[model samples]
Target: MTAFTRGFRLHLADGQVLDGAEFPSGRAALVDDPEFGFVTGAVSVEELLLGYHGARIEWDDEALLEGKPRPTADSITSDQLDALLLKAARADSTWATALREAATVADGGRENDCGCGGCDTCAQHRIGLELRRRADERDGGRP
Candidate 1:
């Protein structure tokens, strides 16, 4: 377990804050409250880093000393880059069409060879669905 000299707060995306959370040996954070003692379960740092499950971590400067450094744009994986581009494409029709066309070509024009709607093999379909979902959200949940 790595203890910080100056502890930091974990500002969660939902507005909940975990004070004095330390980084355990694993890829999780440990919270030891004075009144409640050690908190129940471990908080997955990976989930927070990846912005998964509507949870994202905003690391303060002190937190950087205890755990991994903040992820910059250059550190993100190719898949993450693609997701960001696709997300941006949602706001522009021309970009969205171009991205969809590119994905179709990249996938060899295949719709669903394995019939699994969301597998790595079906890039075009996945991009299409993601774009559609974003559009729906922009349209106030309308399909």
Candidate 2:
């Protein structure tokens, strides 16, 4: 187990501990549960994390294992970056487009994911998606 797996942890930025009624580590796993699929589609991870931290877990859910706490904002940022990368590796152009658009908007005198502060990888994801989209369009709608 990594150091993070031992127990409670905090994100480096704000040092908020997601443990002991403050927040829970199982949020990620819970988010994947089919029972909450409807809510998952409607809410973003950031929003869900903020809104549901410390929220009670229904005891009946077998996947609801109380694990570690939430990490810090910095840790979240890192995770977000990783998520972006994973999305890219999986060829998820929607996220790629969104991230690139975010970067472009940030560069073009618009507010970005103020919380995320934009990233080069996001820009790259956007560019890749755009290129692919254009290629598909040029090929008469076949990727």
Candidate 3:
């Protein structure tokens, strides 16, 4: 069995100590214990730390996972982009439809002449172009 590294220590008000590690997503993952089995899902490490008031926190800088590069748009895969678009569609159908249409046009090498960046059409076109660019990169320069 692999040994778990203690990256941080949380001293709770009830005289209990918890060991946790910082994930690459900036969230804290508490070690598995009898009461809590590998707790996580906090929005961020700060939020998790802030939740327990009147608690002392200890950090092991060497053991903590920090300074990890976050995933950029270029690093996303086409399937991931499609999943995001699908999620957007589920949230806002009209907006997602417009974006899909704009992306289709962009994929066809069509350009929008609208100079106003704030306009809905222009914004959609820009997002669509970016999506196409990422997709092309993922496809090894093939549109």
Which candidate leads in lDDT?
3
lDDT of 2 at 108: 51
lDDT of 1 by residue, 1-143 (tens): 33432234565566766654335443454363546766533455554345434544544642322355434545757765575567555656555455556655645555455356656646556765566556555555654
In the predicted model 1, the residue pairs found to clash are none
lDDT of 3 by residue, 23-137 (tens): 6556667653647576754756678877788877776642222332223445746765676566654555444445556677754434454445554557656767776665555
For all predicted structures, in order, the TM-scores are: 0.26, 0.17, 0.34
Per-residue alpha-carbon lDDT of candidate 2 for residues 1-143, written as tens digits (9 for 90 to 100): 11232222223234433321112333332233334553232222344446554543322211222333333444546655575556555565554455545545544523233243454456644455565565455444655
Candidate 1: 10-residue stretch with minimal lDDT: 62-71
Candidate 3 segments whose C-alpha is farther than 4 A from its true place = 1-6, 32-38, 62-143
Ranked candidates (lDDT, high to low): 3, 1, 2
Off by over 4 Å in 2: 1-70, 77-80, 88-143
TM-score preference between candidates 2 and 3, better one:
3
